[model samples]
Structure formats: structure tokens, C-alpha cells
Target chain A: MTLIVWTYIVYIALSVPLTVWVAHTLHQNGRVFLIDSFHHNEQLADSVNHLLVVGFYLINIGYVALALKEGIAPADLRQVLETISRKIGVVMLVLGAMHFFNIFLFSRMRRRALLQRVPPPVPPQAHVPVATQ
Target chain B: MNHLYVLFDAQCELCVRCRNWLAKQPTFVPLSFIALQSTKAERRFPGIDALKPSEQLLVISNEGSVYRGAHAWIMCLWALQNYREYAQRLAHPILLPFARIVCELLSRNRFFLSRALFKQEAQSVARLLAAHCRPPQTLCSNSRASV
Candidate 1:
């Protein structure tokens, strides 16, 4: 029980900051593209970026918390280490999946915005008739 | 009858303008154009209700692939000579998402833009064609001939 408790505390401490850092990186880098997508609407872009960050926090933190319960209590040091590693590994996978999912959603939004400004293609014309010589 | 067939809204001024612009571009593969509401479109794509003639642009490649919306727009760009590189760049990981957004927005607001910007011209595409054509022939006759 003690080992499991310590592992949970350490995981929370490490994972929270890591998630925040990754989210921050995404926010900073993704802002410019979002601005361009929204036709230079900084307000809209910033709002969207903030919303995405908030969602990232909620989903990741929620996952981290929910995944804290160990299936079986660790009986020894070796068991404790194995349990902690397995938990952290799962957290890392969840984080990576969430990150990619967020990117996919943002990419879709950006695509729609960019395409809105494209001019339509020209209609085809038939060959002009030649006057009889 | 070409490598790519583009179907667009004939009544849209914006669509007409785009069609004219596309016609001017130099492309490696020939792109044939037809109005979405035309008999040709009806015959070619018999049962796909998703391709509402006036709503969105459609592109059918020689390989029998149908691309609508952003994909269709990208395919059109890929057919262009000088703009093909830009098309490829636009499809990149960093850019494709934004491109899709732009395409969707433009597709949604095309009619409004047509009315606002190209009202006069779009209202008289036939007249413009007739005047622009050297021999003073009607576009209707030419359209029939093409059909």
C-alpha cells in the first residue's frame, strides 16, 4: 500500500508538468496556423487555442487520475517497481494518443478555414467554331 | 473525355469566375468542365445525391476516383502546371488541415460571395462569352456542340 501510494504521488507530480509543457508547446506553435486559418482573426484563434489547451488538461489529468488504481497490491520491491512502470507506461501512451487526437482535430479545422478563401475553378469552354472559308 | 472532369454550379458567378480562371491555367492533364445540373453530369454520375450540383465542386479523375470538397480542390490544383508544386505543398502535414478549413468555408459561402462580388458578371456569363468570342456566336450553341 505504501509503495503504491508513493508511486501515485510521483506519477502525478511528473505527469502534470509534462502534460502542461507539451500543451504549451502545441499552443505556441499552433497559434500562427490557427490565426491564418481564421483569416487573421487573432481573437478567434486565441480562444480556440485556449479551449484546446483546457481540453488537453481535462482529458489527460482525468486519465492520469482514473488510471491510478493498481489491479493488485505490490507485495515486494520488485513487484512495486513493476507495477509503477506499468502504470507510467500506460499514462505515456494515453498522453501520446491524446496529443495526436488533438492535432487531428486542429488540422481539420485549419483545412476548412484555408479552403474557404480559395476561388472557384473556371468553367470549361467548347472549341470555338471556325467560319467556312 | 479528359483525365479529370470538373463539375461546378453554372449559375454561380463565383463558380463561373473560377471556371474562367481554371480555363486560363496551363495544365499537364486536360480537365474537362461541366455544370453540375447539366444532362452530362446527370448521365455521368447517375445516383450520387451527395453531389448536389450547385452545392459543392466535384472532380472525377481518369482512374475513376471521385474527390469532393477539399480533396476535389486539391486534385484540381494537382492538375495545374505551375500550381502543382503549390498543391503538393498545400497537402503537406502542416498545411493540409488549414487548406481543408478554407475549402469548407469557401464552399459554404460561395453563393453569397458570388452575389456580392460578381453579381453583374455572373448574371451575364453567356453575354460575356458571346462578346468575348471573336465571331459573335452564342455560348448556348457551343455548349450544345460540346454536349
Candidate 2:
């Protein structure tokens, strides 16, 4: 077969499993944070988690497929390896970026939830001044 | 803008150091520091006894809410950039009593701890103040003749 065909095969073979592994890891680890962020609403947290994982898969798989077309078709095995490495590197960076973005969103949500639960510190009586004789 | 006012004992070296540390933290909400003995603190929070300032750490929110001891410490942490998780964990039911006990222990012995651990920092602050107050030679000589 041609180098282009091999490149597609190698890319898909490597990318799909990597994407699945990362999504699974994020789903597992992020559940606790999401639960806390949603104020211990387990159903809401689980639904959000499932939605995030689905979105992650769609974005990453779509990117991998779109990015499979090389600028220059590889003529030799060395060229093929170099192109694959470059594509994989970009995919890895995109995955990392997505992970951090999700974390940032969840952290902000958690902070807001915490603020909501915190009781107001001062009583109305404390604001009143006493008359001095 | 919401603000958290931290009332600290200015005389305690550790308290001063802690204030400096808290000042450096990235905060979600602005934090204002006031010495419990300061006239400003007295004016802002009337009827609180300032004589025993080291007894508890007090944090007053902009909404007029007051948090004391461990709760005040947790509020301070919650206001910090990345320490919110720790604040949440400490506020948990299982850990809250422990947090309170630790806060109480620290509050009761802070003066001694300050002297033992932060004497050098206190001395440095005194030196810095002294340097600021020192008159320039030319100004001092000119003013001396006027006097």
C-alpha cells in the first residue's frame, strides 16, 4: 500500500486509544470535583460528566481525522515516522489543553457554589451603634 | 466589591508575618488588614474588646458578617487563589473540630510562638521603620539651625 494509507492507519490506531484513555481518566478523576462543584448533586454531576466525556471524544476524534492529511505525502519510512510524530504531538497538546480548560471551568463553578453556602457573617444587630452617656 | 477585613494583633511577630503572607496571596475577594488595637478597627467594629487581641482571629465580611477562630481562618483560605480546596476540606464535618482545636491552641500561644519564631522579622521591621524616620544629613543640619 502507499505511505499515505499507512499513515492514516497508524494515526487512527494510535489516536483512538489515546483519546479513549484520556477521556476515561478525566471522567473518573473529575467526578468528585464536579460533585463538589454542583453541591453534592450526584445526578447532575454524573450527567455533566457523561456529557463532557462525549464532547471530548467527538472533538478529539474529529480533530484526529481532519489532521490525518499530511502536507507532503511521505516517500520513505523515515518521512512517514516524522509526520506521524508531528501529528501525534499536536493531538497530545490539544488533549492537554482541553483537560486544563475543563478543570478551570469546574474550579470556577466550585468557588461559586462554596460562596453560596457560606452564611453571612455579621448580624443586623452588630451594625447598630450604642448611645454613650 | 466584597471585602474581608482581617483583624490581627499588630504586636505579635507571628501575626504580623501571617498578615504579610496573606497580603501576598492571590485573592478572589479583596482582603483588608487592620490591627485590633488600631483606632480604625475600634471605629469600624465598636464594642469588641481589643485588650486581648491574640485570643482569636476575627474576619469581618463586607456584608457585616463576622467569622471568628477556625471559621475565620477557613474564610481567609477560601478567599485565596488555589487554597479553596483546603478550606473546603477543613470545613468538612470530620475535620472541623480538629481545625477548631488547632486554631484555639495557636491563638492561646501565638505570642510566645511569635517571639520564638519571628523575633528576627520583628527586629527587621523595627529597623526598617527606624531607617524611614532617619533625617537626611543636609535637611537635619539646616533644620537644626532653624530650631
Query: Which numbered prediction scores highest in lDDT against the true structure?
Result: 2
TM-score for candidate 2: 0.53
Q: Per-prediction DockQ scores?
A: 0.01, 0.10
Query: Top model by DockQ, which number?
Result: 2
> Candidate 2 lDDT, tens digit per residue, B108-135?
8886787677654546544432332233
Quote each prediction's TM-score: 0.46, 0.53
Off by over 4 Å in 1: A123-133, B1-147
Candidate 1 residue-wise lDDT, A28-106, digit = tens: 9889878987888999999999999899899988988888877776777788778777777887888888888878887
Candidate 1 lDDT tens digits, B35-76 = 654555545655444445355678875544566777778778
Q: Write the per-residue lDDT of candidate 2 for residues A1-133, one digit (tens) a residue.
A: 9998898899889988999999999999999988998989999999999998999999999999898888789999999898888889999999999888888877887777776555433222233232222
Per candidate, native contacts kept equal 0.00, 0.04
Q: How many residue pairs clash in each candidate?
A: 26, 5
Superposed model 2: Cα runs more than 4 Å off: A1-133, B50-52, B120-147
Prediction RMSDs, each to the true structure: 15.7, 10.7
